[model samples]
Target chain A: MARAAVKAQAAEPLDGAERILQILSESARLFATTGYDGTSMRDIAEACGISKSLLYHHFKDKDEIYARITLGSTRELYQFVFDRLPEGARPIERIRGFMVATGEYFQRYRWAWVASTTAFWNDPEQRRQKERMMWRDRYENLLRGLIQAAIEAGELRPLDVPLAGRLILSSLNWMHRWYKPEKGMSAPQIADAYFDMILNGLKVEG
Target chain B: MARAAVKAQAAEPLDGAERILQILSESARLFATTGYDGTSMRDIAEACGISKSLLYHHFKDKDEIYARITLGSTRELYQFVFDRLPEGARPIERIRGFMVATGEYFQRYRWAWVASTTAFWNDPEQRRQKERMMWRDRYENLLRGLIQAAIEAGELRPLDVPLAGRLILSSLNWMHRWYKPEKGMSAPQIADAYFDMILNGLKVEG
Candidate 1:
């Protein structure tokens, strides 16, 4: 009760953006562990230490909270990876950037990522078509485009670009399911194993 | 209506094993498409052309249906791969066998795999612990062990065996998400791409 009062007091003077951020962070934590379907708006309100009406004043419902968080997080993730790239980074380095960025991002925002796993899109064909491109597809295409560029430059061998992109992303994505901090492999170190295998190739030279 | 009637008649004379197989197969198909939470006993009965009492007579509930199908299927999948392993086959071929077997199995029994995604265990600590090992961890351990064997025999490079297993299995596990039989990549063909990439690695030789 005391902590709730303090949190409410701390949030009271903050602007709408800060209040929303606080709400989203708390909502993300809930969604990651309990799942989206398992959570309720009332639960979010309680976690926020705000009234249901106050939570609604910020966002209409749980869906809105989920959409805002996922879209915002994905946009930020893409930016984080792109922002770190050296102006003339080699193809290998660029690929490394992607794998490392993805692994670290999943590690940092696991709950949000897990929450995003639930199916949320339900709309007409055309709208769903456009929604498909918004985040997940765009992320995949970004990886595919990098692989294509590398192959064109002869920095990487010719392989099926789309398949290769999916393969690398698959490995990285599954890390969220099994990665443990206690296992002694940092996100970068885990990423390094994948990066090294991809760059070095697995075959022994004759 | 006629087809359901025919299926019901077909099962009338079957032994318990065949009757159970029929129920599990139909249930797996339903669970794959409609999802476990979405599927109901009545729906399974309608699909199987059996009464609710008859369905209950065979299995207690949805959870029983799920466990039977998943365990039976996983056991079969393991057997399928192991049966195909030739004496003195190279380490790479053995790995290929796992990938192809997994891809084809997912292609064939995708609904069962999807159904197994939901939680079924409800026991206190120890049962849940065993449940975890019974399915996912056991599978991961199997792959990791194969990778470790390859590494020990110097048939493969020394690297993180656990990471490699997850990476390979991830690509295979993810097939149900995007695999389309009509899209030109057969299960074996898709597995080939993964088998090739993982075995040869993706980087071009200098």
Candidate 2:
């Protein structure tokens, strides 16, 4: 075959790392739609066009795959948002940046975000659960810390930091239930709308 | 046996309706913790201290039990909120009442609320899913209607009603992830806090 024709073939072989990523991506889609418990190794293998035995070679079982996807995606989300936030920005701006960055990341990886958030937590993998909880705490704490700084800086009124954090996170997290990229507003635009609503309040000025 | 003594026995015979409610309640608890696919008819029967055959007699299978719990609880939730809201109240107050009533209902029936919200939607029962979606639309429309009234009445600024509605509902819906009655604030109190936050905004007045 000519070099161009060979390169253009539909069955170009994926390297080990690329193949693993493809598996994880496809698995996330299945998990998002069918749920963690509803999905199986055979189903994931089929989705990835890999043999079940090959999938098993990379991960022991569905639980392991779920754990890997959830942990990795959550960590990536945290890092993605963290990197986008301006270091020297005002507290309010940083909070806005955080929300916007998160929404962007969520939109880019919709399936992964849904799979991570909706992953079955009550499964028997206690150690994995603990790790997941740690990441969860870190994620919550990041937002809470920003709220605390804003409160102390007098940009915001004194309020329950955790409650405020949850409020902001709630709006972002629940986007999976209704948001569609093709519908109208992009994720960051929706986030900005939420931020404006939150910052300005809904009540008419006296 | 004496009537009082017999009544004091733990295994007093429950009427049919009461027995069904008990089964639903127990099944809700299981479904909340173990998820829909993870839970089984046998597990529910074991939880309720009833025979599997008896459980099956009441419902055809786990899906029926789930559909019954979800539909019934969601309807109850809607009615509960509707009845508690004041007819003559301003849109803002009506909104507050809705949130508080929902929180109270959620706290009182935490297991059922969790089970209903987390019920597996991808299951084969299209009819139940349709019913569930109808209730969901009614629930969303109730909030959206109030928001539209608020905007028209000049109590609130012109905003995207659906977006505003989702922002409020998100805070309320996400409560199941963390709220606990014994920890600190009651559900209504937390709802009030959220309402205050959303109404007053976070930024300090100039």
Candidate 3:
């Protein structure tokens, strides 16, 4: 009988990986809307219309699901931008491309970005700590490299690369908090506005 | 007998104002850390070592408490900065004072600011909507006035004042998402950094 039960469980159409993804997505939305500590495992199961036992089978707990979702987001973001950085593109074009891609990502995956950022401070567990560090390092390195190249090529002003990188990223990242799709401006339009502001300033050139 | 009961209830050392403030402060912390829907009356009361009945006495319900806290924050912010804007001050100095005061508010009431912003999107109930609209109007008006004054004074190059105002507020608001008191930077330092970036670009002058 035990063997039969095991076989039935294994043969179920709901595989662990699929179940995990569903849980992560639901949890991400809830966390983004409600917050990490605010969401419960029961919330995820109900949102998914699955049994608690079935949900547990896919993942150990909530933190595990949160970590997975955040890691996936960070990975996807890094790959999306870094993979397309053409070797021979001018610094101006490169920076613009990066900003555009970032704006698009913010528009597309607004919830995930919100969840990751909101949870960063609240969860100081060791696992979360490591994840935050890893995510920050990846972005810092990529941005530093881009800014350094721009400065070397005389395509950009010589500024403190690290601070400049933080400012640029912070400006772009802030969009998720306020950008509404219902608004008339598309992501590309917003990106263009930001690009113009960063390249120049509010002052119209003489 | 009813009068006596009423008198007894009123006589309990529970200062309505003080009790309400305590509840608001606790709720802000929980909401900032957990999220609005994640916090409950029981949780809040427990955190304050009071019964849920006492909580309800001061607040009609959770939404009321949330609205009160948010509205209170906006009132405090407006009071802090508006009072400091001197009539004869240069446009740049006025802007700086605004930024510095805003940074101080965030530092002192970090949880309240975070809760207000995060809850604005997550909860769109009537009360939240009212609070959000009030905040939006205040911010828009303040920015519009600042930009006009700056332009009139020739401190800022002419551009879209409304848009510029939104962008400036957006950048400043994003600070709560990442600002940490323990991160080796005070509120003043962060405000200074932002002010410098806005006044001057990262590029060294040719």
Please give the DockQ score of every candidate, comma-separated. Answer: 0.44, 0.56, 0.20
- How high is each candidate's TM-score? 0.75, 0.77, 0.65
Alpha-carbon interface RMSD for all candidates, in angstroms: 2.5, 1.4, 3.4
List model 1 lDDT by residue over B33-58, tens digit each.
67789999999888777789988999
What lDDT score goes with residue B97 in model 1?
76
Report the TM-score of candidate 3, chain A only: 0.70
For lDDT, candidate 1 versus 3, the one ahead is 1
Query: After superposing candidate 3, which stretches have Cα over 4 Å from the reference?
Result: A1-68, A114-129, A152-160, A204-206, B1-67, B120-125, B152-154
Each candidate: what lDDT?
0.70, 0.79, 0.68
Q: Output the lDDT of residue B181, model 1.
A: 59
Q: Please give the lDDT score at residue B138 for candidate 1.
A: 62
Report the lDDT of model 3 for residue B126.
71
lDDT of 1 by residue, A70-182 (tens): 66556556765667655588877788888888877666555555545434322235643455458677788888888888888888899998899888887776666667755
Shift in Å, residue A198, candidate 3? 2.5
- Counting clashing residue pairs in each candidate, in order, gives 0, 0, 0
Can you give the lDDT of residue B113 in candidate 1? Answer: 58
lDDT tens string, model 3, B16-131? Answer: 65456456767888876687899999988876668888888778788887777767667656766687666688887777777777877677656667766664435556775676
The best candidate by TM-score is 2
In DockQ terms, which candidate is top? 2
